[model samples]
Target: MVLFAAGALLLGAGTTSRIFALTPENREAQATGPLTAYLEGQGENGAIWLKLRNGEVLKGRFEVKVGGSFGAYGKSRGIDRPGAAYEGSGRAIQGGSPAFVDMKGPSGATVHCEVVNDDANAHGSGVCLFSNGAEYWVLY
Candidate 1:
């Protein structure tokens, strides 16, 4: 009976370790870097926190606006699904607004992006598909 109990305990411990293991998804979410730097440039609000790779942090709030030439609100392009089943690529256009951080590249330089928007919008989930290439996220 003692031997059986010991086996069961080991199995349970292994299962728990697997459950707590670091995954790519979790790493990306926890790994702060360039994203945090850009957010710091934007300054403070109450809605979001930008964490830097070097251990600095910034806080900010963002509001979403839809109008004018900026795709008429709600209408957007290039959103990827979870599990990396879909993908798209584009170039960052230059513009000025609190909601968007401009991502620019050399002439004719295009980069890939995947949607990882986890926020929920009225239409559906807000998770965006993005890559580690040249791209920016609309934080709000």
Candidate 2:
């Protein structure tokens, strides 16, 4: 039985997957569907603030470039960093057309990201806020 349990853990199934959640409650949140979010804006170290359907929010630093390959930022595994990180990698599903997706995070933080074009750096000058309570800003 122990061997079977360990094998299950190796496969990253529902059982072991929960062990890796950012928080205990965050683990359960993973069961929810993939988070829906947008690109918001390009930030230093690729950080982005996602505005979600719910009133909650998600802020993280990433390494995504405008013309670089796409990364699956919405995954639970991508939240290892404190404020910002480059946690996901994949093809650009939305290309340069800009897209929004339902994003999920630790502690049931549901959020979204809307793409904005900002080429500034330092003193958090590379972000733009919207009336919808969403803002895309740089981490550094």
Best by TM-score: 1
Candidate 1 per-residue lDDT, tens place, 27-110, comes to 454353224222111121113233334443433332222222222112344233123211122222222211221222333222
C-alpha RMSD (angstroms) for model 2: 16.2
TM-score of each model, in listed order: 0.25, 0.23
Residue 1 CA displacement from its true place in model 2, Å: 41
Cα displacement (angstroms), candidate 2, residue 123, comes to 29
Q: Which ranges of candidate 2 are over 4 A from the true structure? A: 1-31, 41-44, 64-140
Ten residues in sequence with the least summed lDDT for candidate 1: 1-10
Candidate 1 off by > 4 Å: 1-46, 68-140
lDDT by residue (11-109, candidate 2, tens digit) is: 222322100011112333333322322222222233334443354565543332344322243223222222223112321222221112234445555
Model 1 RMSD vs true structure: 17.6
Number of the top lDDT candidate:
2
